[model samples]
Target: MDAGCVTAAHRVSCHTMNADLFKPTPERGPHQSSGTAKNARNKPEQSKPELAQVVTDSRTGRSYSKGKLLGKGGFARCYEMTDLSSNKMYAVKVIPQSRVSKPHQREKITNEIELHRTLAHKHVVKFSHYFEDQENIYIFLELCSRKSLAHIWKARHTLTEPEVRYYLRQIISGLKYLHNRGILHRDLKLGNFFINENMDLRLGDFGLAAKLETVEQRKKTICGTPNYLAPEVLNRQGHGTESDVWSLGCVMYTLMCGSPPFETLDLKETYKCIKEVRYNLPSSLSPAAQKLISGILQKNPSDRLTLDQILNHEFFKGFTPDKLPPSSCVMVPELHPPSPAKKFFSKMAKSLFGKKKSKVEKIPCEEKEDRDISKLVSGIVKCSINRQISYKTVGPSEVTSPTGQLVSSVPLEPTPAEEESRKSISRSFKGTMASGTEPCEDVLTPAAVAETAMKVLKDCLTAMPAANRNPPCLSRPQSFLWVTKWVDYSNKYGFGYQLSNQNIGVLFNEGTHLSLCDQRQTVHYCLTNNKHFTFAANSLPEQLRSQKQIVELMANYMEQNLMEGGDLHCEEQASALPPLLLQWVKTDHALVMLFNNGTLQVNFYTDHTKIIVCKSSDDSYLLTYISRERVSYTYLLSMLKEMGCTSELRHRLGYVVQLLQHHTDA
Candidate 1:
């Protein structure tokens, strides 16, 4: 085909040209003839009516069956093809023989294939075999089912900072490999960044790629997508590794801001913007992101950040996940880092116990007592108490009931210090008590509390009828303890929750619990079910600072991003010791948490519904249900057991029971 009568096949061979190749005469560059540009625009390119179902290799005698079209670019059409004998899948790029008729065009294709086949890197697309027949040239490649970043960008207009870091890191790795090999990609855009099924990024599309040359020897070709072209390339200064860096900056900008930095209505205007190194930095971008973009998009190629320098930039220091979920391609991903508390505790454990059990055993008794205080606080050792005798044997014949009321029990006398400690604990419990109830004369151990709560829940679940319909909404007091807002950062840190009373708590992954209470002025930390320490938030020990920062971060995130789960309200207790989360279990459908204060809560994932069972200050079991509509209803647990609940609540209760049973059994 002649230049003026270029067909789709011919266009494929010259795929490195600008996007304006099909534009009308007036928009053509001054170097192009008007008549030729008009003829190229007027001629509609042709494509084969249908891809051949079976294609055979000329020499190897291997046959392949083409499945579906993967994508089409200016150079070739990619399809899913499987070798009939081996049944191995491959992403095969098919170029019609007619496309590479010209000697130079054929040479370009040959150069791409040779260069790509020699590359072997984790981040670069794996090149397979290539063969040609009379009809077309087929180059087989590793199948990347996830398509490319272009599709992801189209689906999600913008990506999170962490996500941008994740993709950029891989891109840089691949770019560094090519640069180390004295190669310049020349073209770097979203469409060239392929994603595999594993969510790994594979740099592909080397149509405009070239070997690096000294400044004087470099070819001054205006090739590459217009929006991504570096100013030096447009000015005929020649393509270099820096040109690729400039394009990378553009890719980053596009991923974060949802559009190329130098893009404009007209092609010439875009070139003007690139030449001037001009683009708007949206205020919405993070400071690190803004700084990185500015550093990479320098007017002078040498001034731009190098691959290593870009990787070390502050923008990359953020939480880039080890791997991304496939769902992230179409939507925002829910990413949670390991909790700071978990990390802190782990470090402390390693320092105290060493890595081996032999080392732990070798520790001197005195030193162990001094350094292993965390073990005491972790609540692994339990003081076994018989359920029947727990309430029967006490200092007084009267025992505190679940409702904080005095109940008949065996009586005994208490020492003055014991009485004083009891009074202190009673005062702390007063904040969550119902009106007219008296504080228990004794403190219940965390284990006892958990056991009691579990038993109550188990009984309630067993007695409650199956859910065939919605549960009846009972009108009762609205005041109850429930999670108003929560965030799962369990992947890194832990699960965080904000109580209706404004107490923020995190059940860390390491089984430790930290809570911000007294309007966040006081910090309550629990190492075990019963052992805990209370501190003035500002006076936290140096070792606990990291955990504190993480909790604060989760609190701030939830406060700003999450909506309240229900309308249930409880007055903030500025002096109360918040309940400690003893154990938390996460299943596919829900998160179940058991508190040391005899409270059981289950939050459903499918719907923002919640079930909270806690004792009322009036000595009765209270069940609070938060509906998906952010409305709450409180009912007596006994009443629900007798009247039965709706299927929605019933199903959740069943799941909670199973979780509790598993926890107990384990």
Candidate 2:
């Protein structure tokens, strides 16, 4: 086998790599174009077999006739293709295996597919299926004939408030769906924001997407264009869904003012402006648009307006998200460097410097609460002081500065804040600290223990375990008052409450701002009211956020234990989508698709389900391929059964039984 070609047998050896290999190290020069397949790659369709080139999917045996090149990007070149059997059209993204042979790159591709698979809304781009061959991976997606919003933005330097509102509503809807599903679109820019022929803005190019499996989860990767990055992201402070809100504010500003609020000639100045949270609200804009943008452009992610609030703003007086029609798309003039629809590859995060053609300059996004220049500088100082600088030993000798002056082995005296941080960590894990019997000098090398100690301190700060950990469910036996009433259960095992449905919403809404996943998905019920309530989330962190499904799960769990039956049957929700039978649900680990399932309760990305698409007018459906993990059919069957099934679903279930029985009749 070739040195670069990955074999399944050597998979483990492939991932244990040098730590530095994962750093955002920019490729020094022009990228090497590696796809050499004469038929699958660059050759024009006219020169290929017959009138058009034909590509067959090995997994499903479906065939697509390649048409024209739609655009090109860092990892893949997209083309317009026609499904021969259905005569349907799509944009196929072709990525060579060599491009994703490495573990991290492969992980990225898998995540992108997973995220795209779970997201389903009128405003989000629809992902169909992914087909792979030995040399390349082909991703099938909805064909948006209008190219992207960047084209429109470039053509019309600034849009009228009405036009901005038109696009804003659609964008927000898609974002709301993503946030509800515990996913974040880290990268948001006009270039990656696409629109279909129906003038509907569909968010796409989720190469920087991530999942928030639990409520306490937060992401640290500094992805997204420098210009569109939230302040917390730049500060290397943990970030969540609110970061996307900040980016949306920047995009909203560009829609009204021709460019991002703080557009500088280069990234440094933009970053500086963002750190200070400096920007001017255009007086010429409508009061509603100005007020909304200003609110969204707030320095603190906590202060930003929620998507629901934005939707209800005075600016959208006559416009409602559901009422928005699919009008013919308005194609604007194209921007510089040709196609503005540049998507991400694992290497995109490294495209900030030197010679890559894609190394174009970036703009800055709206940011956190008002940051004093001193505070910004101090934050940098704090980051530098705490960072773990890797050290290697040549000999057990005294450390020295570059000037050859010897350095002290002991830790420096702590400042008041540092002392506080140490005290807090000490309290959290008092039993783990050493007693006075220990030696005066610490035995661990500074380099050897620096990384580990910092991780502990970080975990202490969040009051949450490390990312990979599934900490035991909250078990505090403490009690608290609910308004004026006395709830007997003060300390609960999980995050459950004892209050009325109305009161529950009132209390949950207070200080519980919308946030990224912060805890495991569990249902908490109020014994007093005998009802479960869900809180609407917002772009603002700590605003009310609760899931109705959680209560449903709790209800099911209780009923399941009561009966002698093995599993509890799903009780249909009065407000849920009109359920339909899953024409087919793939049991394999690679993909899961349910056809003709009516509108979903929510767009969710989890082990239980990653909604590919709701029932379609064409009656066709799509799904995502699980690469890193595989789920069993029995588990899938039980999960769906617990969630409840429509008559049609049972109909299909009977079809399967009959199909099995028919074999015996023959």
Candidate 3:
């Protein structure tokens, strides 16, 4: 959106999947190396992929058992693998040596590893470790199973001005981290950014990252995704960090307009439009947002606003990073997490984009890939849960994807007022910090301050007497705040994510304890019974009371497993329910049910879906919720979804109910 927008800072929490890179349409077979000779490449010629359940990492010497395929793109395929030692599941980017055959390609990977290893920031994806076997290089990454900005924008159309700032503030913070370390991401796109369960926007896919010895040393590499590429890169001019600023402009525009400004079927046509600085600046954007976009999209690299200047812009008046979740805590998720289906959020992210699961292209037949996955449940929920890109027009610019897919684009007439608009918003601040440079009053934004304060508190808490300490419980990292948003929309109690282990939401917040709102923000799910939670008791017919039982068990299980820690594979958790009543679910947690009478129904949670046994008060016999003869699995799932519960949650409950209905309880 070439129009105006504002800035605001908020906390986020979540995980991610892919890196932003061009998907090369390689015609070669899996065993072939296209660019480099098979014999001379770094890979061992005869060392084929072995059919083994476990593979040892050449770097850490740790072995990870392979799980399901997460996604495949560009040069590699990512897999869900369990660290045999820790039993902690991670996403492993398995890049065949066939893909890294070229010297330059190999160096890029090396540079990526080095750059990722040296950096640590909340907005950037955390790299755990990496190693190479004879056939492939395994890059172990923090598994982020959330929507990318691209996925969200495609569904919702565009973000509101406040939401724009909400995402952009973190993007800037992440870039600032990389810039400070003298690393040039080189490639920045909607696909490269992800919102974790925390709601924080993360800058990921550093495969094309570059390292500069100093800020002044410019690199003349003409590499980047076509749409987001800066003009300087196309012209073969030596470029530095300023190039990233241009891509950021594209990102901001896309967020506002719901489409990239310069996409076309032909790359040359796209480049031409960008070079000419043509765009239909939407009138819908606030003056501040328009100014921000126009200021950064300058054709000349030197003419764009610096990161510091952008942060200080009037658009960011209410921006506070403290509201955003810390990235460090969002990393290292628990094992065998829930699937991130095409979850969307327009008018409740509208309809879920049910993308077909394309199989991971290459798997050894003798060695099988784990197909055991939880039910795929996604799509944003209300308060009408929902969800936007970029620039220059070429004859009422028509939208197009990389593969020549034609889509609608917003076209604007090339008006003189728009030209003047562009000219009016020229860079307000230029160049690097110098001897007489103006000191930014906002150099330490609220988020930075809060982060620092939290660190100090952490250190102090470490030294405190165990019995005397009560550290504050924070909320989970979230971007869209879906669960909270649902609570607000559905007027129900919220559950799912927690800011931290100790900080689970308290359920009695709705009306019963309106005073709780006075204490802190209202969360959808609250601790109705300490670890137990219930809906806000909104008294609405749509409230999923059964969901409370499901979530409580889920929460209890998550907490217990968390306390146990390391190498605790979720599958190893013994099912408390019997096999006759067990159910397989795709959610991060399993839903089990029990009954003593119509009134005191008990629900249980398991790591995976399985028939679990219920322990009685006297510790003697198995129990069932016998109050009502049979609760139809189909009816329950329908009501759960009708109440705005996620598909993952609803499906888990269905599995156990199905078992109870069909098996005829003994």
Candidate 4:
């Protein structure tokens, strides 16, 4: 009987093995049918289909009958799910409990959501909804039918000007919108820029935006892409929107130069180069482009050109959208919480450029290195004119040799007509102030006034010899002549620069000096040594806008540039000059002061000697011209080779200079 039971158990085990492999079923055994039934009942019934069903978003009253996995990242897992209610498709990012269970992680995600929910702009990606499920969190975002900038770069190898410009303008616009609202998108890079199917670019992943109560407070954090990070950010003294501007500059430089301006195989070296702040822009870049780069990359944040300033730059002239694109066209991205990536770079940048401990006290002014800057200034004053010691053939018979001799067979002497002209010119100007009501602002002491009058008289008397001379004589009207040129330091706006070495366009009226008082209403003595100009407003009902204050700011900036020994060494060989004319121009909220006096202006602007190639693929083209402001010169240059300006206005402005005439006449 025991053997019979054992045989029956063996037969039952064989049946169980077969059933487990294929399908579970009841099988008849010789004598242990009752035992098999008891074993099956004790084990338990199979699970019901409903028990193994996947959970749906029932809280949102949304259901997805068919869902599939899409992608995964460090933060979340994305899935392609269908909404059964609307029969619409959606991409859902599911964050697992393991990821956001920590307080810090949850806080970051929440911050990101809060930022994305409110921060809306055309070039930023949009976030729709956020919620939590049993085991994971869900963030629904708009599906973008486009590729990342990296993908585009990989596919296209590089970008064309049009493509680069389009994306840059979009990015700038988005950043402007953010900055205007007092937010800083801390993470910016080419990878953050996404291009859609329509080839329109959108800024994505605003996980690092920091909102500040004040404009100055915006730069409290040190965060950004390594390659695109600014030096100030690395130093961590405090950063502002200027950081973003720096990144934008890097992007632009990459667009033009095929890589980031400070690039190396090693990350540390790359950052070191950035801190060193040295770059070699291709020589073929336009002056406008160079000006843009210089302004954006300035070490001082306040000195760096603002968004409005950059938009008006001449480099962007070719790409500014004809019609202003709406702000809503771009996607609004969710804020990304602080992550390991952010922490890693922030720490690296800090350690690299952080302030080093010093055991020595700073040197006092007396102990500081003596540069004798005044000596340099004197050099500038002396070398202000073209007084070349060597002489070449200037005109046919007007040859004055090195020996100071008349090589011709004639002894040159003033004619009777010249003598009479000289006598009349000597007595021309009295140089004394006309009798008038002495205003409190321009009041001069009797002795001081007399001294000034005497000096004026001396100047007029000294100049009589040159003014009285007839044409063809070497002597001519020798007014304290100088030319000042205007350059666009920031082109995103229409801000013009007043560089003394270049030519600004002709002005309608030149300004005169006026005595300005201070807040005390005290009549202070004139102190010209400091170059301080006090403004006495004739009319005022309100305070000044920062842009209006830019006038004084620019003057101070120019003074600083001058005091620091500005970038005039390259042009030191040419004649230096001061402004013959001063203009105080106000347009809307912007004001510009023009001083037209300098040799650079005469050579490049007035004479049209410089050839500015607006676009260039290489540096060879950039070496062609100097920076000068002459509206007419730029206009005439475009059509010069076709319509010969010399033949057209042959008698009007006289000959257009032999060298320039050759270029235009060609």
Best by TM-score: 1
- Which residue runs of candidate 2 sit more than 4 Å off their true CA positions? 1-52, 213-217, 318-666
Query: What is model 1's C-alpha RMSD?
Result: 23.1
| Model 1 global lDDT (CA atoms, 0 to 1) | 0.69
Off by over 4 Å in 3: 1-54, 58-61, 213-217, 318-666
Give me the runs in candidate 4 sitting further than 4 Å from their true place.
1-55, 64-74, 77-93, 213-221, 319-666
* Cand. 4 Cα-lDDT: 0.41
RMSD to the true structure for each prediction, in A, is 23.1, 30.9, 27.7, 33.9
Instruction: Please provide, for model 2 over 114-223, each residue's C-alpha lDDT reduced to its tens digit, 9 standing for 90 to 100.
Output: 77987788888899999787766889999886777676666666766656777887788888998988778877777667877656788888877887533345655566
Best by lDDT: 1
Residue by residue across 1-666, what tens digits does model 4's lDDT show?
001000000001111111123232322111111211113234443332211012366566554422344443344545544443343445566667666778987887788788877866777766777677667677766554443555444444345444556677788888888888877776676656766545567776655676744545444455566667788777765557788888888877776666678877776796788888778877777777788888887767778888888878776765433222222123221223357688799898789989755568776643331222211110110000111011111121222322243221111243454334324322321221121112233333222322332333233223333222112311221122122333222212122233333322221111111111232121111111111122224331122122233433444454455321122212321222222222222211112122221111122222223322221222111111222223222222223222333211221111112212111111
lDDT of the candidates, in the order given: 0.69, 0.45, 0.45, 0.41
**Residue range 1-666, candidate 3, lDDT tens digits:** 111111111112111111212132323212112221212234443433432445686656676655555555556666767663444667777888876889987987887788787778888887898888777898887765554676566655576565667778889999998988878887788767876766677788887787754434666656776677788778767557888999899888887886777866665797799888877788988889889888999988889999999989988874333343332232321223223453224333444545545787975632321120111011101010010001122222333422233322222333564434233222211111111112244332222322332333233323333232122211221111001000111124322222212222322212111111111221232111111111223431122344444444445554565432111122211212101100111111222122111111112223211222223234322211111112111112112222333233223223333223211210
Cα shift from native, residue 164, model 3 (Å): 1.3
